[model samples]
Target chain A: MTTLSLAPNPALRSPPSALRNTLTLARRELRDAVRSRWFLLYTLAFTVLGLAVSFVSAAGTGGSGLSGFGRTTAGLVNLVLLVVPLMALSAGAASIASDRERGMLSYLFSQPMNPSELLLGKFLGLAAALLAAISLGLGSCALILAWKGLRTNPQSMFWLCGLAFMLALGMLSVGMLISTLARRASVAVGTGIFVWLMLVFVSDLALMAGAVALRLRIETLFAASLVNPLQVFKMWSLHAVDANLDVLGPAGLYAVEEYGALLHVMFAGCMVAWVVVPLLLASVVLSRRSPL
Target chain B: MNRLRLLAAVASLLACVPAQATQPDHAAPSADAPTTSTVPTTLGEIGRRVAAAEPGATLVIEPGVYHEHLRLTKPLTIRAGGKVIIDGGGSGDIVEITGPDVTFQGFTVRNTGIDLDKENAAIRVLAPRAVIKDNIVEDVLFGIDLREAPDSLISNNRIGGKALDIARRGDGLRLWRSDRTIVEDNVIHDGRDAILWYSKGVVVRRNTGLDSRYGLHLMFSDDVTITDNEFTRNSVGIYLMYSTGVEIAGNRLIQNRGPSGYGLGLKETDRFVVRGNLMVGNRSGIYIDGSPLAPDVPGEFSANTLAGNDVGITFLPSARGNLIYANNFIDNFNQIAVAGRGNLDANQFWKGDAGNFWSDYTGYDQNHDGVGDFVHESATLFEDLMDREPSLRLFLFSPAQQAVEFVGRAVPAVRPEPKFTDEVPLMRPVPVAALPASSSSTRMPLAAGGAILVLFGSGLLRLVRDPAGGPGGAL
Candidate 1:
């Protein structure tokens, strides 16, 4: 972990531009993600889950009589809710924190690039990897379904994949924020997992309990739920498949009635904001703390 | 006033017109070059022919468009020779059959008046034993309004209502006190409802209706048999209100998602058998509101496949005395829900070791028997809360719902009691008669699928076993 071996010697090489440095850093991060075992495992598991969903939906109407529109996608969405954010958080929190722990950030910063570039490059690369994994997993499942001559709607799958990727990006941004704040890799990883658990399970339960106990207004509960991006993902992803969100009850009905056809655009915009805002805050923190 | 001056100028303009231009087309012999009295071209000419005919005579109408309203007072068989059209000039009832035993067949009757107060219809039958068949009644208000026409038949008629607001449009087929009638093979759409008010012994079969209000709405109609009908995209499929001895069988009710989106709404209905129907994609497959209202009579529901509905059976809290067996409740979000907070224990979930097959049934069949080993009880605390506050359904398939379910599982004290217990739930779906094939789905193109397969297949191999070893030491 010596900084001398990676010293920025002016006699050896000229400095590249900021864009080039960022791209180089991005490519490195992408390669790292590609090589990771957990990434591959997640993709494989997603494929298996996709196959199960298709099989369950297509099992059919002879005597089983489970006919009409398939609702097995709900299971897929549930699993996505449980896992996609965790995947993004772990991968993201490890990126910068691990570099800091290995004494690589100091050496890397000694080069021509700035801290903001490094963070942006890492975020972009991780987001790209996440998107690719989501696309391949969902696309392979759809492709398998099409080849099997099953009930495959590519349009619906497209929206779902987009939703999952968008959700992952938001989680990744939050992970970047955690990584920027925490000094140790273990602390960052632990914080990321804790955030995931709180977001995925406990907070929602507490909110529900609090709402019931306090007899909170539906509008209050609805407004409060939107703070959890997972809730937004659920609202919109379920809505993508079934526009009539009767299963979702009143809140879903309100969303449909309030937003109508533009609800998808609203969801996409909200997700984009979720990604951009946290990443900006992380960049500010990183640049201030590690003055290049 | 300026209006009075304009009226005087219009009157002066009318006075300047030639006297010949004011003559009528129905005037005696000036209609055409060869004016044969037998070949009646106008509705007025036909009315003359009908008036001169005997009490029970057959009038074969020539193929042409008659732009006038006509009424038949005596018993007559009016059949079209080829393609007879009776256009009402968009002002009044096209045809009125007041004669007993009159049969109107093989005509395209259209363009009836749009006056709601007059109840303008294409064919308004007021006599008994009339047979109206093989007709195309369109561009009209009320399609075939039958009043006191007993022992009559309306068959093979394609009827469509006027293009107006939904509330402004009239019924496609309205029968009032018309007993012992048969409505068969009619395809109706874009109307308010096909209602049978106080009509008894009416058999409506093989009719296909869509984009309407009610497929077949009945009020106080008894001994009605509605079978082999397909009603899709309607407000309510078949609503039997305050009726007895009705049989709704072999019908397909699909996608009825309007405000009152029930495939069947039985409000205080008694002695009904709902059998062999396919109820799909409805908000609530069957809304039972105080049904089986008779003290001793129970509603018989059997062998129906209720699939993909939001709630298979939504019962008002007071609904009970229903014998539900041999049905398939599949993939509905909430299979059976009570509208308010009440258990469904009063209704019979099984009868003598025979019960419906539920897709959400967690019980398994041991020893390969047809019946499940454990009793299938369906009442999660979430479902109970949903019944109490329907808005709670918003949490379905969300973490909040799963969190509640987890808590309910960990601590049984907070878990509400089960709604219904199936003592011997069926292991398999009952073999109800097959319905029409599901509507087609647009599949992903082969090229797209191939592209994905090729990209992912090779990309994974190269990426997983990267030749550059240990590149991500920091990660």
Candidate 2:
């Protein structure tokens, strides 16, 4: 009852796959960053700052008293958390928005590839550059900590690196969204920062104002927290530190008890949303709009 | 004649005993230390002589401003006679008590300036069951700083000062890692934060804190119940962060007006009972901020009056599943605000559909009942456009706010609820603390339960260590 229709031999003449293009782009980006003065400057600045903070903290605790490799590593981890996303955002802003401004995007788009390949390739390139810089900086700090005979929790480093990756991806996605929406690179970067401030700081401030005004229960505060991914990230990070000390109240205990598994799922969901939503939206926009 | 002969015989026996066995030496030397005839010239000499005295001793001080840091490391009483004064003159702490069962009374202690760099205090009590009562501590950084002293009483002290001027100034009656202490009926006025960090089982009652940054600042502390206190003209009535199991009842938060001020600022706090508190004439009332990093802290808020504030209640992004029921939101500028779609599922709003009163409610009660006719869909136009363009928030207080509010209420849009509206909105205001009283403490359970999880993790590690059984079995 079914008619066999003859179609073009797609396997015989297929376009390049996304994974191969993405890797090639990533390699190109890595090479570009290695050749760039900006990348070198960023690495040098972070390294110097890391050393300074370590020295200050160590000196204050009394030099040659207690080796503070753990403390120094914590500081480095904190620095990575703060800096990696910022650098990712910068790279992301340039990925597409700057290429279009320079009129080099049209040529790339005209190549034998789809919009997904172009966008994915661009994202991969930025990620590769950021990861290299992050690993180098973190490794240097880690080496110093090891030399000082400090106990660094491998699990902590694992979680930290994983968190950094997620954050960097989220920031990059946000940047991509901005790049697609805005005509200029500056606007993309500014918008990304604006988003960061809102998620990290303003949301909590607004929630605080509400709780004070309504005199609501602790459950309400917990429910309100689910809307911000930064809170989820922070809660998970703190849980890693000390689960009991995460919240300073019994209400916190109840919330954690009530929504233990759900909280993790929700956090993962938000992280995915923060990444995929913006990137998907950007892709849709990029596909429609002129790359140049 | 018989009674007179008996008295004469007793007197003759007493004289014979002293003459035969040196009875006067034992009785006189022992009794002399308690009530010394000699006065000490120097502070060090006084300490040495006091140390040398017998137990249950009292070293009385004469009139002079003794500029010294006296340390009491033994169980003794230092009672001031007449006008005894010890002044550090902004150099260091006047007295540091580091002994059990020690008592300090009736001295004018002054000028305990906190070196942001040091643990400076007028008196630092580091003993259990110590009594620091009826002392006049003025112009000191901390009137009485207690450290890990349980069952101690710091009462009836007139502690006055220019509250710590530095950003690092802690509580005037600061308790650091202390437990089961009572700070009652004291005047802790004009301090940075009246009762600061790291204390448990503290009952801070009948206290007055005026002209301070925060009336009570509880940080990393638990099981503190502050009641019947008056906090006036302060930046915040109470700023509690990383504090748990705190019951703040029957307190008057009055006239704490300033830029960025609140009646109560609860952040990263859990398991609190905020009842019967009257927050009046503050910029904002009862601000709650969840740690954006750690959101699922359960909290309960009930029966608190928001008499006069710019905004009554606000819930930010990341506050969720909270129960905000049975509260009076009367005559505030704005009643409630929840997050927008930009901030989703961060908070839960319930009982809002039930008849919670709103000043801006234009809906008619067709049945002529006390309840409001319409559910307060409190989405404002300003919030929507602000989510799209946040830079426009600078004009929030401008005349445009009214226009925005008008437009927002007109549109029936859904926003996140603040979790405050009662499931059955009360016909009348419920009294704060009207519920059945329960005395629950916030001591964390023994680590035995957590130890099991550790063992499980260890077991996993052991399994991984055994390569023959672990990896091959899985493969």
Candidate 3:
């Protein structure tokens, strides 16, 4: 009896029970995120940026309330693209690595939970937190815009929020992958920042240089955009807000013609792949590594 | 010698018989009393009947597909009863008119030969004083080709082409050496250009050209007047190449944002007037390459509204003596982007006391006059750097660029050369007659909402700081 008790259990729990445990872990993580200072800072930053953009754009239209929501959204797209990715990356990069460094990951692993459950729980929890923070920030501004008697398109606003969420999720997955690969928490954080810089800023510049050097075609430029999840998000979000694809130059026009109705579906799929592939890689890397 | 005489006599007899048959024995149709002939099924039979009829006779063609090419060399009117199609069957010019004082109306002309070198057209007019109206021309190399057809009227025609790549398509309407022609109230789409080359005294009015390579392309066309037209979603709205004495007024050039996009591209053009035009949502509202080739005779641009463009007015460093005045520059990404880092002070930004209204201007109007108290100068070090290195354009709207701009504003010493300066900047935008009325209301409520948001943010901050509102307490 004593030997049997000490041995590993053979029978697995039902799917519902496993799902319950995952949800509980997710809720706990989410609760912790909401109370964190980083979440507050991100929310505040977004609100301030949104308001500033709206005000400036409104001033151009002779100060007619938030009638410039579309313009404001266009202006804030770059800012959100830069900052949200950084926030999501830092949050996710530090989650697993910091926990491992602090010996909390080991403690969590000792519980009646599988590795997949834990990884998925953390991802869902972090994604929810980021989404909540962004919604509050962007939502408040939109409400303010509405309160000012300006016409706002709910569809476009929802689409913008959705794109931002997907972008955050994509960055988080990448950060988690870095976390699993790195030996130390500091290394994970450093790598996370570098990756964010590369994806959000450096990649486009590099692509531009390559385009000039090779005299790249519009199709080639479009194909290159597929490799970067942030670019996909940017293109989709801008297309959603601005019906005129001309602002995106030649590549955008090609996308409208080639993809047409399936453009959104393709973008969403690319974002999902960005999340799934990185998480899968992180899982494989984590499983291979020995526990502290 | 006997056989040769017999052959010559036979040829003479054949020519005289045809001439006698074609003689107009029928009475000329009065303007009020039109003679309608609907029996001719083929274009060849219709042409024969038209030649046999009197000079002012009106022939009403019945609904049918006429596959034969037509040549009208008499002063007669051919009116279609219903849906009459003149199909060229991929042959040469579908309908060639050498007749003076002819009117061709209400026919669908299609499927002309696709030989750009041959300049095949659905309707080719070679004579003077012709009116081609209410015709639908489609899938042709050129829609309406008028060569040396002076004082002709081409109006109320719908011209379309196959949706091919821009380079493969031909001009919708081409007028070569055609003088004092009028092209009015027509719709041209999905073709190369509505071109006028070496044509003098041409007037293009109230036309809409969309999804074409170039909406209005003028090469060496002098004394042309283009007014009240809309050119939308084309590669280039109006391209003036080596044209002189051109006037473009009251036109709306919108959303022509293709590669090398421009609302108006002026290259080596002189003595042009661009006034009261609305250029919106283009890559560059007006791209001046080598306009005003001679500094003494500058192009005049006044009373125009350039809004929502990447760059309002871009000038090559060599372009000089262009007078820009009384225009509203609104919401452009870069107000003025010069190709080279040369001083643009020589180009006039103001006319005496009146200057263009810039939305980005921060100067105050203390005396309650419409003009701002201070001069408005546009151009910064960052923009100069961007001009010098085109690759830096990738970083447009980036935080680094914004930070640099902020720093440039904060520190005056680092400011770059002024691209242009207005001595008397307008406090209010010039009222553009062409633009639709804007629906912007008061912003007082937004200001209040902003205040409330600030308070809400601070409250949230307080909650975060409170010991009771910690992680355990919140859960």
DockQ of all candidates, in order?
Answer: 0.24, 0.02, 0.16
Pick the DockQ winner.
1
**Pick by lDDT: which candidate is best?**
1
Query: Candidate 3 chain A: minimum summed lDDT over ten consecutive residues — where?
Result: A1-10
Between candidates 2 and 3, the lDDT winner: 3
lDDT of 3: 0.75
Q: Tens digits of per-residue lDDT for model 2 on B392-475?
A: 332232223334556456755633232343333434444433222342422122122223323433343343234443222221
Error of 2 at A103 (Å): 70
Q: Which stretches of candidate 1 lie over 4 Å from their true place?
A: A1-23, A52-69, A106-117, A140-152, A214-227, B1-70, B79-93, B109-118, B162-165, B437-475
List TM-score (chain A only) for every prediction. 0.87, 0.79, 0.90
* Of candidates 2 and 1, the better by lDDT: 1
Runs in model 2 lying further than 4 Å from the true structure: A1-292, B1-49, B58-64, B81-83, B162-164, B168-170, B257-260, B291-298, B338-373, B383-399, B409-423, B426-475
Q: What does candidate 2's lDDT look like per residue over A34-55, in tens digits?
A: 5567667766676567656555
Clashes of 3: 0
Locate the minimum summed-lDDT window of 10 residues in model 2 chain A. A1-10
lDDT of each: 0.77, 0.58, 0.75
TM-score of chain B of 2: 0.70
Instruction: In angstroms, give how far residue A189 of model 3 lies from its true place.
Output: 6.6
TM-score of 2: 0.46
lDDT tens per residue, model 3, B14-64: 211311221121112111111122122355756676768788889899999
